[model samples]
Target: MQVLPKGVRHIPGFLDRTRQEQLVEAIRLVVAEAPLFVPEMPKTGKPMSVRMTNCGSLGWVTDRDRGYRYQAQHPVTGHPWPAMPDVLLEIWNAVSASNKTPEACLVNFYSEEARMGLHQDRDERDLETAVVSISLGDSCLFRVGGNTRGGQTMSFRLESGDVVVLGGEGRLAFHGVDRIYPNTSTLLKHGGRVNLTLRRVNP
Candidate 1:
């Protein structure tokens, strides 16, 4: 009952090695209730080496004068964004063929010298729902492209409970994350790499 290949998916052990250690203890309680830093790239505030954080109910951020945006709190601790762990909304309503229940998750942390260039996530407010991603710990290099820029490119390695699904028009296609292979997954305990992106943010 694992899936991932409608254009790109691997689903290696699609969650259930005891729920993959309960999704790594629910992402370490959402990084201890939103507590990871290293953001400041807005208009040259300069300081992004991938270390951001978030939970549920909205929490994606950026600063280089705003390139990406999502907020409900926590722009440096306004205190409010952290609660999407009912096992990640039951794995986003069971892989969401179209049951969508994601109100923003965007918790990305990577560190074997972090890397996430080439981007494209169109400020989610409407893209026909579905951008569900959830690859935890090590094994990177997940590049995807289309919607015109050379029109075709692909890469994969995803691993660790891999579950990626883009929507309508490939949910605006164009993807990122192309690095980090160091110490490739010993099953988390501090080694870096966590990407939980569940979208649909309209407030």
Candidate 2:
């Protein structure tokens, strides 16, 4: 088994092609309902490279005025986020090791030139709950490091159908996408990467 940071698990190709296709379709429906919107950096108001949307009861969002927060309505439309897909709930149940279902599913779309800065998912009320992420479409370079900043980090490629779980000691670790490799997979017709992160927002 490939070793990683404590409590961090990477399951490569966890979903088969058929499942990936089904996930893609499910995401399509979610996008149609919620729509992707650009997220801005806290205070700075700098727009993130990737576009984002969400499903489930709460959605993580950031902007110059509000900073990072979870809300029940879409930033753009003011409508509640779409329901969490059953496939995602099943994945979380199988791997999260927690009885509570995730209340937020952040959907991030990265173009060929997009990347994310190293950051921790720390806005949730409960740190005990694990964060589950699923990758689809093109591959990307994922970077992860210790809980503290400027610590030794590692980079690895995350391909389509891969699943990553951040739990226990690794739950607060810093991680992000360095870059996307276009055309690495034929999963998305337009050639981009979609990342789904399921998180429990409240205690």
Best-performing candidate as measured by lDDT: 2
For model 2, the local distance difference test gives 0.95
Q: Against the true structure, what is each candidate's TM-score? A: 0.30, 0.98
Prediction 1 TM-score vs. true: 0.30
Q: Which stretches of candidate 2 lie over 4 Å from their true place?
A: 1-3
Worst 10 residues of 2 by lDDT: 1-10
Clash counts per candidate, in order, are 9, 0
Off by over 4 Å in 1: 1-13, 16-44, 51-61, 67-91, 95-111, 115-133, 136-159, 162-181, 185-194
103-166 in candidate 1: lDDT tens per residue? 8787788888888776667887777776788888788888787655566667777867788877
- Residue 82 in candidate 1, Cα distance off native in Å: 26
Q: Provide the overall lDDT of each model, using Cα atoms, as 2-decimal numbers.
A: 0.76, 0.95
